[model samples]
Structure formats: C-alpha cells, structure tokens
Target: MTPFQTLTGTAAPLLEKGKLMSNVDTDMIIPKQFLKTTTRTGLSKGLFHELKTRADGSENPDFVLNKPAYAKAGILIAGENFGCGSSREHAPWALLDQGITCVIAPSFADIFHNNCYKNGILPVRLPMDVCEQLAALAGGANHVFTVDLATQTLTTPDGVTHAFDVDPGRKSNLMAGLDEIGASLKVAGEISEFEHKRRLMTPWLEPAI
Candidate 1:
C-alpha cells in the first residue's frame, strides 16, 4: 500500500453522497484480467468500461466517471451519504486500486469508509455547501488541489487553505498507517508478557501445560 501525505490534481468533483456508487455501479467497475495490472496508471484505462457494454459497443455516458470531469479525478469532493450502495469491496478497491488516494465528501457509507481506511484512501466529510464550492472549483481550467485528512485541511493549488474535521482516533490511525489489525498488533508483545506472568502466578489455572 502507498503512504499518503497530500495530493494535488485537476480532475473531477466527487460524486456526492448516495448518488455516487449507485450512479456508477453500472458495469461492476472491474474485471479479473484488468485487476491483474501491476501499476496504477494503466489501471484507469480499464476502470469502468470492463462490464459497461455488450458486444455491440454502445456506451453509458450517463455514468458519473464517464463524464469529462470524473475521467481522471484524483481527489473526489462530493456530497452527503456517499458510497451508500452495494457492499462490494470491489468498488472501493477499484478506486484505490486505480490511484485514488483521497476522497472528500460530506458523508460515506459505513462499510465503504472503513474500506477506504484499510486500503490507505482518505475519506473526508465536509458540509454540502463546501462540496458544491468544490464542484465549482473542479470545473475550472485544470484547477489543482489537495486534501489532508490528518490535518483536516483542504489546500488549493493557489495555496488557499480550508479547515475540516475528522475523528481523533481515525486521524491517529491514518497518520500512523495502521488499519484495525495493525493497531491490534501494537500491543501483542505486552499481551504475551502478561500471559506469561499469569501462568507463573497461577500454575493451577493453566490446564496441563
């Protein structure tokens, strides 16, 4: 997994709230062979087109990602209730697996948000107005920007800064690059020491070791 400190791009505004995954889940988003890519750059070429069409070659321009703005989006600043659809890990996996390290929106589906954390993607929540402003910003002439989940700040390429919020615990984990399993492992040595002490204190409590 990649370590993330900041991101800068001139791409699409995030798909807001519940509309995102639902609006774009059309083609299942990926295929087995494309998933085998060894790098992120070429991965975008295989993004959503994998399951979108039949042999006839017609296209679904209605998909959010197909829109000109979202085609190469890096930081997604969207609206509330984002990522609310299917429980497919493939969705978030495909996103991160496609070089998206930062996703900022008003809200995110619980499972989706968790998936972001584990996969090293930063999922942020801002107010609706903020998302709208970001949408406008994203429409400009190749506007560049960055979102830092650790500092809870958004930085435009012009150097403007906007403060945001994140759960304190979540902030710590992201900064340290620790997922749930990684967090638990931090105390393994202590737990082992305690169990050894317990055995010495009460041999009777230990079965026939």
Candidate 2:
C-alpha cells in the first residue's frame, strides 16, 4: 500500500482544507462488524455496504452516498463538523478499512481525528466551498483523488496540487508509525531527567506506597 506521505485528492487534492462536507454520514463510513479488527485494513469488504441496506445487492436509494454528488467518493468530502460521536477509534478504522486513506471536512471531533492519525488515515480540514465543488465532481462516474502525506500535499487525478498544515511532531509520528505511547517512550531520557530534578527540589517528593 502506498503510504500517503503527501498528495491531495478531490477538492484541492493537493491542499484540501475547510471542506464543505455536503454529504456522507459517519455511520456509512464503517459498519459494526469491522469494530472487531485490532489492525487496520481488511475492513474494505464491509465498508459502505455495511450500513447500506441491500436486502439484496440492490443499492439503498435513501443512503447519502446514493445521491449523485457523493457517489464514487474516494476522498470523502464531508459536512461542516464531522466525525462526531462516542470516541470509537473503530470509526476511523472503518474509514481506513475502506480504500479511503484521507478525509476532508470543515472540522473533526478531537478523539475521532486522533484515531484517524493512529490508523494511518489523514483527516484534513478545508474551506466549505472547496468541498462542495468536489462533491459536485463525485456526481460524475469517475470521482476519485490522491493524498500524499510526505510532502503535505493533495493532488487531483488531473494533477492539480494543494498544500496543507500538520504539526511537525504529529507528522513525524505518522511517517515513522509511532503511536502516542510509542513516541513518548522514545523520550524516556527527558522524563527521567525531569524526575531527577524534582527529587533534588524536594527530597521526599517520591510517592509513598
């Protein structure tokens, strides 16, 4: 799998931000069965369709994505505020389970956004209008995109590019596959140093049994 170190898809594909998120609900991103995976991926088979009622293989006309503007959405151009719900890391997992490597919305719930990063999904924020245009594009049969994390870029299949913002530390964690605890352990020395100093300031500072 190509780790999207950098590239953009859909809207600015190169720089998608403040995406208007015209459609697509969080429930459609991942279904219940996928909640079982400890690792990401392999959730693709159950994605979208998990929530889509097909009593048979027939599409659920009432689904958000069934609407022309959101069909074939590879980059998930979504609503003003997205990823809102109980903190289910599985939500992002489900998004990753599908082929969606990146998501662009106006804003993301804190825990949900962090979960996306942990699972190798790059959740982006874009201005609302940008997302609207992309949703419009999804109306066509060939709606798709590419997100490149390395260069912090978003590129459309047509080759347009856009720049995005990310915390350097967080970006490094994603590039290096360091989870929060993993990254903190790499700085054990610094933590140790601080503890030593605190001990000096108060000899009895250590916690009692």
Candidate 3:
C-alpha cells in the first residue's frame, strides 16, 4: 500500500439525479463477479461495473466516473453510509485501482471503513451537510479537492478546509504505508529473539525430524 500523506486532484461526485446517492454498498462499487481474483490489479475494469455498464454491455457515459473530466478522479465525494453491505476487501482494491485515493462521505460501513485505511484509501466522515457541500463543489467545473492525512483536513476547491478525526494508530499506519502484515514485520526482530529463547528453554519441544 502506498503511504497516504496528501492527495490533490479532481473529486468525482457519485450522485443520482443531481443529488448525492446514499447507501452505496460494496457490490455497487465492485460486483460479485469481479471478486473471483485475489490479486488487486485489473479490478479497475470492474469498478462500478453495474453502474458504468449499459444493458447491452456498452459504456454508460452518464456515470460519474465514466465522464471525461472525472475519468481519473483521485477523490470521491459521496453520500452517507457509503461502502455498506458485504465485507469484501476487493471494494477498496477496485477503488484504488480506479485511482480513488480518498473517499469523503457522511458515514461508512465499519468494515469497509477499516478496509479503506488498510488499503491506503482515506475514508473521511463529515456531517451530511458538509458532505453535501463537498459534493456540490465536486460537481462544478473546478472539482478538485485536497485531502491531507497528516493534517487530518480536507480542503475544498474553493479553499475551505474541514477537519476530521481518525484513530491515531490507523493514521500512523497509513503515514508509514504499513498494512497489518507490514506492521507485524516491523517487530520481526523481537519475535525472532523471543522464539530463540523459547526453544533454548525447551529443547524437548523440537521436532525429531
């Protein structure tokens, strides 16, 4: 996972009929069909698969992400309860693959929120009104937004800054680009030393083979 310090780029607003859409579940982000692969790469093609695809399997140009200006959007301004439903890690994988490094919403599913941090995606929770403000800004011509994890602030395109709270441990891990496995490896030396002492104290426990 890439270390998340600061990200400044266009923010795509996931809206419906000009209003922010709520309850965006994991299946909507990346359908079950795309969950077959354990690898993270190549899932971008399946990102928002249903919403971005027409009945005839053609591209839905109307989709927020399919639009020309938002095609490479690195930030997403969404509604409440984003990333709801199943606890698939592939949801974040697909988002990351699609170049979305930050997701701003009023709230998020607990499991999905944790997965975002683990996968280098910053999931920002703000008041619904605040999120709506950001979403409105994102829909305009100047839709760029900046998310600084170090500062724990999100700056809108018009220079308004909003603060957010994150767990210190999660913040630290993100800044260091340390996932669960990477964080465990950071204590490898201590683990090895403990194992050596344990074996010295109980030689009989060693395998005969």
C-alpha lDDT values of all predictions: 0.66, 0.63, 0.93
Give the root-mean-square deviation of each candidate in angstroms.
Answer: 4.7, 5.6, 1.8
Question: Considering TM-score, where higher is better, how would the candidates rank from best to worst?
Answer: 3, 1, 2
Best-matching candidate per lDDT: 3
Model 1 over residues 5-106: C-alpha lDDT tens digits?
667765456343423322333134454456564554455555555433435766656555566756666776656666666665655667765566777776
Query: Residue 59 of model 1: what lDDT?
Result: 61
Best by TM-score: 3
Q: TM-score of predicted model 2? A: 0.69
lDDT of 2 at 87: 72
Candidate 3 residue-wise lDDT, 1-209, digit = tens: 79999999999999899889899999999999998999999999999898999999999999999999999999998899999999999999999999999999999999999999889999999999998888888888899888999999999989999999999999999999999899989999999999999899998998998
Which ten-residue region of model 2 has the weakest summed lDDT?
Answer: 10-19
Better of 1 and 2 by lDDT: 1
Instruction: For candidate 3, report its TM-score.
Output: 0.92
